[model samples]
Target chain A: MLEVKNLTVSFGSHTVVNNVSFSLGEKQWLMIVGPNGAGKSTIVNAISQGVPYRGSVYFSGKDLAGLKPSELARKVGVLSQRRFVSYSFTVEEVVRLGRYAYSSSIFSGRSDDDEAKIEEALEVTGMKPFRGKSVLTLSGGELQRTFLAQVFAQDPRLLILDEPMNHLDLVYQKQMLELIRRWVGENGRAVISVMHDLNHAWAYGTDALLLDKGRVVAWGKTADVLTNENLQSVYSMDVYDWMRSLLSRWSR
Target chain B: MSKRPEGFKPVAYILFAAAMMTVMVLCICAGSVNIPVKDTFTAIWNTVFDLPMPEDIPWSIIILVRLPRVLCVALAGGALSLCGGAMQGLLRNPLADGYTLGVSSGAALGAVIAIAFGIYVPGFALAGTMAMAMLFAFLSLVFILSITYRLDCSLSTNTIILMGVIFTMFANSIMSLIVVFAGERIRSIMFWTMGSFAGSNYVNAIVVFAALLVFGTAILLYSRELNAFAIGEDNARHVGVNVRKVKLVVLISVSALISVCVSISGTVGFVGLVIPHMVRMLAGPNHKRLLPASLFSGAVFLMLADLLGRTMLKPLEIPIGVVTSFIGSVVFVYIFYSSRKAK
Candidate 1:
């Protein structure tokens, strides 16, 4: 389980994520939805230890206040909105990097178990076809999947993805979401993803958190929190009716 | 696409052989005095194979003076360019080179002090000067790295470049003041600053060769770490790279290499800055390929530059620094134009 308590993040004098709190049990998925600059991404970043925050985040009964990046990486896998690669590394090489946290000794060679995990990750993301290809040569959608394969190789207890579907097409979007859902179901892991598409959040997410201007406006089960009133208020658009129709379609 | 070849071993061997041949021929053919290719080969073969010395040619000058100078040039050039290539990876900046981050300026100041003070203590003058250069280079690297650490932020390429520029300006100003105050040693200091292959003997050649071997091997061992760093520090850290530790190791290793080169050759410019970029143009930005390629190409490029410097002016003998800058600027301009066009 993962719990965030009174999380507050500020940039300079302005607050970006204000007094946000939430909890997620194993085998649960929480999708956060908000408009641009609404602090949804900031909250995700704060939870992933990408940014400093004022409050507490606990994972599996341990305080995550001062954990080193490597320690945090072992427990949580994060996929940020922007990923940059400056070298022409093969897809397999990049995925193998995910085993860094688990490698016991620095000088010792990578073991058979590491290769097995990497192969499993490649199989899960369906990136085995391009495993030997240079990541710099990959297309946008294919690159995203490659990164997903890396994240899967991490085998973390908590998965945090910020805009995982940003550049993906509809087919890849479905493929990635289905993979995430299946992984969580089988491993009983916790996932928190920030998404812009309301239909996608409603379709795969078990719970929803709505943020507005860095404040959580509503948080609960997906169906309870994603009301017409809340959606209209948060988005500042008369999209409640459309959202309701979409929700019905998602249920079917 | 067609099935990729099983391995790159054949291409690697071909490149290695080609580079070796080019370096050997260029080394022999270059110098102020025009020794025939046949004579050069005979001299080399006689020395190595312990055969009878040829009577017509002066074997002493070729073996003692010219051979060591050429070897030093090749080794130093290869080491500097390889360091520059590794720096670009370590710093994640395409423009990074051996002299970036103020290492060359620090070395120059060390050399300037050594000459101006006339710090000659019997047989220890050269050793003392080289030690001073290494010390200054290491100190400046530590200062930059400490500042980077204190900031607790990734050292951005822009920040490091700016820091290097500031240090370079400061060192140059101090050097200028020393030059003004002490005019007697001006000739010696100027010679050191302008850079040359003169007076390079077997000792300096051996030192540079050994240093290059050690530094190059150290860098190759960290190839994976360098590749991770290329992706940015946050990602590298997430991938379990000890970013700070790796940065310190690379900084120290490259600083040592640059200091040793500067001690012997006195800041042969442009080879460090341009050769790595040229190598990257041929081989993509993969460090595994780029690092070794840069080393070989840098050696060849500097040998060619030295040859041009030696032969172009004939008896006058233009400085190697001058030739390198002239060639490098043209290449830089071409790169700039082509990159802009591609964009």
Candidate 2:
């Protein structure tokens, strides 16, 4: 479980996220939806403690402020939006970096369990075949999957993802969401993801928070928060009929 | 996935270490006063085991002269190469090194000032030129770091490298001024800038070697953290790497090592820049293997370069910097062409 209270983030005079708050229960998936610059990514970043914020984010009843970076990482795995690797490490090596928090020494930190987890993550991401290939040689979708595998190997209780499906094709997108659903189903984990596609939020999210210009437009169950009027007002488009048709099809 | 495990190859490391030692011995035998390989090995063994040196061996050539020069050369080369690798990892750029970052020029400025005014540390036998060089090197890095820090912008690899180039130009201008003033000693200044180990001794060599051992191990211990950093700073932080701490430790360690190298053996150009690139090409980009491999290969490269410097004209020795630059430029061209072709 994770709780954020009155979180406010700003850069200089420009406020990006203002007075937003939300809590994620165990085994729950919360999707943050908004148009461009709606501060969805900033909200997730504040919760993950990636940037300095004006409010408190508590993880499993512990204040995130008191935790060391490694301590915070033990319970939280974050998949950021942009990842750039200048060097050419093998895919396996990149995945193994997720074990850094579990490592006690530089030389002998990885255990048998860790290796198995790495392999399992690779398998789940469909990257098992390319484990030996240099990450530099991977395509954009493959590279995204490589990072997805890394986060999976981290084995954190709470996963914070910003635009997790950015480079993924339709099959991988469905596969990645299914994997997250299975993880929550099995391990009682929680997920907070920022998504631009309302269809994805409607299908995968148990709860949704709709934001507009750093302000919350609606929050509650995904279906209730993404009402036709709210969708029309937030996006300034007449999508009521389109949203209803899509929801009917998804429900069926 | 392949069934074979993926880690640094032990055989490659062993070969590199053996080659470095072999080249070291060959260098000792091929100096101005050519000592036999057998006598060189015997003297080295005697020194290692505290046995009495044989009377037939030339003590000056084996102990007083060649040994210290060779050790100094190897240590300087190893330290520079390691710093280069660490710099590349820290900034997440393959082209970063002391030479490109102006750290070497900063040390050269310090050395030039000391030589110009005849300023030497009294009663600190190994502390004269080296102490000044290290001081200026530290100051130069601090200046560069502060400028970047004060900008309060995310530190980009391009920005830091550009800062380094600017600092290099500034230092070079001052150095040029000093060179112009020293009408009679221009050749010595030029030789110093070109880099050499001809002026070293056993005392300074031992000191620099000890420093390298201590700091080099510290840097190696951060290979895992460096691996995380290779994925960009945000990912590194997300994965629990203390980005600021890692950067500080790496910067301090690398700057200290570069200062030590420059103090002992002027600014030997491409050993720092090209050795890491060469090692990465051979061993992939894992810092765990690349760091130590670069050290070994850099030692061999510099030893061969210094040897060529000594024997190319059979008495009219070329400068070590000249030899390295020539070889480095060729390697740079080859690497550029190959990388473009691969792409």
Compared with the true structure, what per-residue lDDT tens digits does model 2 show for residues B7-124? 4678977787788888889998997778889898888788889899889988667777777888888888888899888888876767678887789989888877776766777776
DockQ for each model? 0.38, 0.66
Model 2 residue runs over 4 Å out of place are: A107-109, A241-252, B1-14, B42-58, B113-121, B128-132, B142-160, B178-187, B333-343
Model 1 alpha-carbon miss at residue B122, Å: 9.7
Best by DockQ: 2
DockQ of structure 1? 0.38
- Per-residue lDDT, model 1, residue A63, is 83
Q: Each candidate's lDDT (Cα)? A: 0.79, 0.82
List pairs with backbone clashes in candidate 1. none
Model 2: lDDT of residue B300: 80
TM-score of chain B of 1: 0.86
lDDT of 2 by residue, A44-130 (tens): 887767788898899889998788888888889998768666788989999988877888766674588788889999998889999
